[model samples]
Target: MMNALAKQSTVLDLIDEYDRKAAGVEDAIKAYDDACTAIEMAGTIMGTYVNPVLRGKAYVHAREMQKNLLSSGWKAIYSRLNIDMIASARDKKLFERTLADPPPLTFENAKATFGPYLENPRSHILRGLAETFAALDPAYKSHSKVKIGVKGLPKRVILSSFGDYSGTYGRDKLRDIVNALASYRGQPLMEHVEFNAISVAHRRGDDAILDGRVYVAPERYGKADEYQTLDRGLTIRLFGNGNAHVFFAPETLKDINRALAEFYGEVLPDAEEEGAKPRTGTAVSKDLQFYWSPQDVIDRALEFAGIIDLKEWRNNSPEPSRILEPSCGDGRIMDGIRARGHRAFGIEYHAGRAAEARAKGHSVLKANFLDCPAKPEYDLVVMNPPFYGRHYVKHIRHALQFLKPGGTLVSILPATAHYDHGELKGEWRDLPVGSFAEAGTNVPTGLLKIRTPSPSTQRATSW
Candidate 1:
């Protein structure tokens, strides 16, 4: 009885194996039939037998019971996975094992591979694409050496269309692509390439209608799709070669050497040598005071409190004269203070600029406010931070902590900072100077000041 039971169990397992094999064959046949019918109806009958042949081949291999159980489903699963591994694989022979090129990395390919950015018109979808005269240059330049510099081993490139409602689409993707390009070249760096958006102008009467808003009929009337697309407001802009210039942070440039090798096969000997050094350089510097803009919040404090006159504001304190200039740019204000014969000190975050300021033989702290050591802190603080972006705010908050209780803080901030957080309050009124202006395309010249009274001193001086 026991021997019979064991035999029965083996037979049942064998039956299950045949069941799976039959099901696979049926499903494959159904799919092949559907594909063939569609192709034949469309009058494309040339490759119709290919899928059916593959289906028959799979069934033939699975005819045996042992093979069915051991190999069924698993080969299909593995072959599907092998598709991706083959495409990304460095080995050329891997394709035979995979049997196919992998599917495109669409934003909706899978939960892991697909991302939400694909839906956004502004998102940079195509990253690390090789720049071509056909793609980038309207007319191909035979030997144009003007390559967009990518720093690292770049793998993909992201491109965005100006037809976006919200403009925040491709910024992060652009950043990632730049970094990938740096990494692809066997190095680790990337350079940002910003392109300005533009609308082709139509000559209307004497004035050129620069804005491409007016979508007329007949030219687009027959095509409803084109009409909707053209009619719906779209900004004609994308990244690369544009009117709006963007700045890259230092970390962004660090990946450029790697990108160069990956994108262009040529081995850039200089990039390899440059990347090897411990202290690397980047491509960014504050444009010298040619068009220096003041921070309105800081400027307002200075204005409200009245300018601390150059004659009276000078602190000639003999007791180890101390002052702080956070985000000090080329030590302009600090130099002015020195010219007034006041022993002033400062802190600058940029290394190149800091060195420039320090070479003047004044004690300029060559450290970031956030990262600087607290020892021998400042008694007075001053700065003109980046107004276009909020990176300066982080430094501002850091500088505030460095000040002594009665320490003076002088700064120039954009007026936008006022309305941004006026209701929320703390440390804002530390100075009482204020100034404002509307047309700040050049220097706003608006200044403001605020002062926090020290309990130690009964006397008051204009900030």
Candidate 2:
């Protein structure tokens, strides 16, 4: 009975194989029929007289184009997948066996090769298609060069009208052709010999069109199908069998590069390296609520608080010579405080930022200010707290405890900080919208000068 079961299983497997082969043959016939229909339609539109034999030849040529397109598409798509996926034993073997192979560009082939992965409906061919698309430009309008195979017996190229409802018909066709030809070359061809003919259609209007003529069309025009839409002088299409066409405009090329990068999961290096780096002067840490106070603002706040006479501090030492600035990112405010003939201490939350402050010869405590023990020894307290909701209130209330009796506190806080929090009160002056621009924020801020009352004035002025 076991032997009979084994024999029956083998027979069933053979039957399944037979059915698969039969289905493949049926699919091939259908693909040929479709190719014939496409060739006939193209010839009819172009007014090319193709007899039955010529039609057969055209069918072969069209199939080659299709093959090239699909091959390029697959190559692009596979190249962008994560290394783990590509390096799997199964995929590795597939890749090794097909190194010089441009898989035949056909629906039947795609179905056979990719059916398992495509079982999930989310599988797509856009990236591979974009690679093929990028290959069509004779000048290779790409920052990074990719070789496209172009092994073919074609001095003259075929021009097929891509009439479809899809908005990306031109881009899709170009990718198809590029991939097809690239695969044919066997070796990668970074530069491509120009196409025989290229034609594209876009909408025309002098109206308020936001996306340009290529993207927008009328109600009657199903997107990308109107061939004559190019006749309105809105588009430039390639024509005749030539090795030279034109490169895309800067903006168009930019958009293409951006799209390709997204498809390939790549981030292009910034062309202008200078512009890419953050401007250190204006950079601030929002998480730590560290904002760099400008020298002018520092001077104004100190003078307004009546802690340091500007003329006296600049010329001689002030009465109370010690200053504290908690959350001193980069220590710009601390630097200003020291320049005014006063000793300054800073507590920076970020170690990296604290190091920067220390490098500039400032005393930086690399710890969160809230966690630090307050000595109440400092004569002045200055802080720019993070205004993420009501964080400024928490920081300000804590900072006040660090100043001694009759000591002054100067803070550059958000406008809302004054009205919402009544923990500490003093003379307040509203600053401009971009007053803290050096700190990398444009939130409107106010300068507050609050002084803890002396023993004598404590009773006169209620707490």
Candidate 3:
């Protein structure tokens, strides 16, 4: 009886596996049919309805304005402006009254909706501030002399020079410069530890050696970098070893810290934790690997724009392929994709980047890719994913899930990822060093090309 039960379990597992394979085949057929139908419909509409309509009177004035209104801030303004009531300027008294006593400025008002900066707190402003801070190795983990007090309001800064690289200014002058800058901003200077003038041999190298780092906050304090107005205070000066130093005022620091904490919430570790390792350049690279996909790289990935080789998706192939970029920074990769006559949709997490992408006329969703829900409807998925530890590997795994059964996933990633995901097999080629010059780092990178399993087969187990 026990042996019979074990056999029954084995049979059930096989049956479940078979059911999954069968579903994949059905999905493949549906995707193919859908693709062919969409392409035909799009072509017909573009050639017959769209081109003629755009040149016609109906589209030239009214429809064009309606369309332009939805592009950016115009939509918000148009909605709240009460166009119907304000359209006629014939009655000066009625117009004045309407303008002066407009409907209670609702949340729909652009000014009311987006603060003075025209940026939302949650999606735009706050996220940007947090991203800036998060890019820095936590203050506690930094090898730099300054320590940030994150636990309270008006975060305190502690300064201590450990190495003897105070360049020509010397350690004493370094401290004085920092103190003077703080005073200029009307902030107090706290405990200044005695600078230990270590000899060149005794001093170990540091990662944070100042390289003229400038922290700009003109909004909170007047231009700190100007030499004439703030001559008494030093805005730019060499720290030990000629490392340049620039800092923000206490109020500015408090505001930034608050935003960072709010954006991170429980996910960010406490900033005060001792023994936390500083984020190295490599670590930071992983988070902001927004390197644009080189045209040569794009050419190679698509097999010279040959994307329809997979047997499963042959039926519904788009004339100019449909492409999805999960982290399309400034839409560079998308630009290349579109240049090839393909339709590209992008997801950019940074508000600024998303805006730039929109300005370039590419459709982009300004939201975290992980948070956005996607359909397995694209013929290709392309990206240069962030390499924060397992992040690149995970992104590849996620991208695979969004592809039509036999769609392709192309990405530029650290070579280390080749070994991370054993189950998902792909072809990889080494990209030259310094391929990411815009990102400010040169690490061994590779182009990984992965094709999803054909519908006729079971899912890739490793993915």
Model 3 segments beyond 4 Å from truth?
Answer: 1-289, 304-318, 419-423, 458-463
Q: lDDT winner among the candidates?
A: 2
Each candidate's clash count? 91, 13, 7
The list of candidate 1 runs beyond 4 A from truth reads 1-321, 375-377, 423-453, 456-463
| Cα lDDT tens digits for candidate 2, 308-423 | 53456455554646789988878877777666656688998777879999999999888878888878887888877665556666677788889888888888865555644545
lDDT of each: 0.38, 0.50, 0.48
Ranking by lDDT: 2, 3, 1
lDDT, candidate 3, at 106: 32
Error of 1 at 5 (Å): 99
Clashes of 1: 91
For model 3 the local lDDT of residue 70 reads: 32
Q: TM-score of model 1 relative to the true fold?
A: 0.30
lDDT of 2 at 226: 24
Candidate 3 lDDT over 61-82, as tens digits, reads 4333323323312333433343
| Candidate 2: segments with Cα more than 4 A from true spot | 1-290, 307-320, 419-423, 458-463
